[model samples]
Target: MDERLKTNLNLWNAMVPVHVDSKGYRVDKFRSGENHLFPIEREEVGDVRGKSLLHLQCHFGMDTMSWARLGANVTGLDFSEKAIEAACALSAELKIPARFLCSNIYDAPNVLSEKFDVVFTSYGALCWLPDLKKWGAVAAHFVKPGGIFYIAEFHPMTQVMANGGGVAHAGEAKKLELEYSYFSTAMREFPPGPDYSDHSVTLEHGSHEWMYTTAGVVSALLDAGLQIEMLHEHPVCCFQMFPFMVRIEGTRYWRIEGDPIPLTLSIKARKPL
Candidate 1:
């Protein structure tokens, strides 16, 4: 792994326990049957019943297991051993017929060689990758001919803004200010933010991240020979990636209320027949 990825992997390892306990991950809810996949995926990747699925960057496998629960023969991969371990444990407990592998997305072909009917990745997956074109090619390499590659991620336009940049709040909440850059570049280190659930048990680690514009993602996949099928821009977001964002309908967040400006986006592509 490169220095940037290595740094973030360490932070993700540290986050495993914290995230498991955090309400945002909702471990207890998952235990009860929450299935963390968003509705957009459920619909976009529809009819997964019995098809093979390869979920990349499958952090702890909640979504992967959910696919298994819905009847897809599923395998999930991630570079974080801690996350893979946790995913394996969850699979065993839930008895979800799924396989979990610990390997970097770039190295996965060497570790596990199998094509799938569906190649899928979801929210928060892309930023972890240092290379967009290579990532897209790797994704294309994993799906059988005529199979699909699907992703629903934060809009790259939204990514160009400062993460913590926001407007003022009235109460004790911290005020929003533009303190970071707005261009595509690798983040060498990020001070860990608050736990998604509890802010009290704070932890900080030097981490890494990257950026990919909308064109970067689409063109890469196209260059890799995945035909563009559907691309939908959503006004709602899955998380409050920015400070001024507000929750809209059905688990979606947005920077502005009563306005739709593509905060989230989803794409479906297929290999040539």
Candidate 2:
């Protein structure tokens, strides 16, 4: 593995416990019958019952197990061994009946050899990978013929904006401003700090991520031979991606109080029959 990848792996391993304990992950709710999946992705793909599902970049397997709760036979893969271990422990503890494998995405095929009825991935997953083409190929590789592959992710247009470095003060909207280009191959570096679930508590995550245009994502998946079924973009996001965003009730989604912009994008594609 590349040194950068190894470094990121170490950080994710260290973060597994914190993530499991964080409110953002809501592990307790998942145990209490709260499905960790968003309606946007679920409704679009519809009905995974009894289907074999492969979830790539499945962090600690909460969502993967949630899919099992929804009636999909699930397998999760993550680069961090600790994350996989934590996920396996959680599965055994909860009796979720899912499998987890710890391997780099590029090498996952070497360890596991089975096609799935659904190849699934979602939010904040694509950016961690550096190559979209390879990522798409991996996803397509796992899908059985006539199965579906789905992704719900933050739009690349939104990714161009910078969210880190505390914030830059403005007179009215005093928050972070864009310090980097909207389209660049710069891997962001963060200091040791709080995990997303519990920001008040300090943790360490020295990791790297990459950005891709929404079009780039679509192109890559298409290039991998999946036939497009449905693609949708919504004005609201599932998370508070920006400091200036507001949460909408009932929906439990965040919205920018402007003329409305695309916050997240979802695409569902099918493996050929």
Q: Could you tell me how far off, in angstroms, the CA of residue 148 lies in candidate 2 after the best superposition?
A: 1.2
lDDT of 2 by residue, 28-123 (tens): 887787888888887887888999999999989988988898899999999988889999998999889999998999888898899999988888
Using Cα atoms with residue i matched to residue i, what is each candidate's TM-score against the true structure? Answer: 0.89, 0.91
**Residue 162 lDDT in candidate 1:** 48
lDDT per model, in order? Answer: 0.80, 0.81
**Candidate 1 residue-wise lDDT, 1-273, digit = tens:** 687788788878877887777776778998998878888888988989889999999989999999988889999999999999999998998887889999999998899889999999998888888888899999999989999999998777666544432221112333233444545465545676555445555556666777787888899899999998999887766666555567665563445565435677899999987
Residue 79 CA error for candidate 1 (Å)? Answer: 0.3
Model 1 — TM-score against the truth? 0.89
> What does the lDDT read for residue 88 in candidate 1?
95
Segments of candidate 1 deviating more than 4 angstroms: 164-183, 186-188, 249-255
Enumerate residue pairs that collide in model 1.
237-253
Residue 178 miss distance in model 2 (angstroms): 4.5
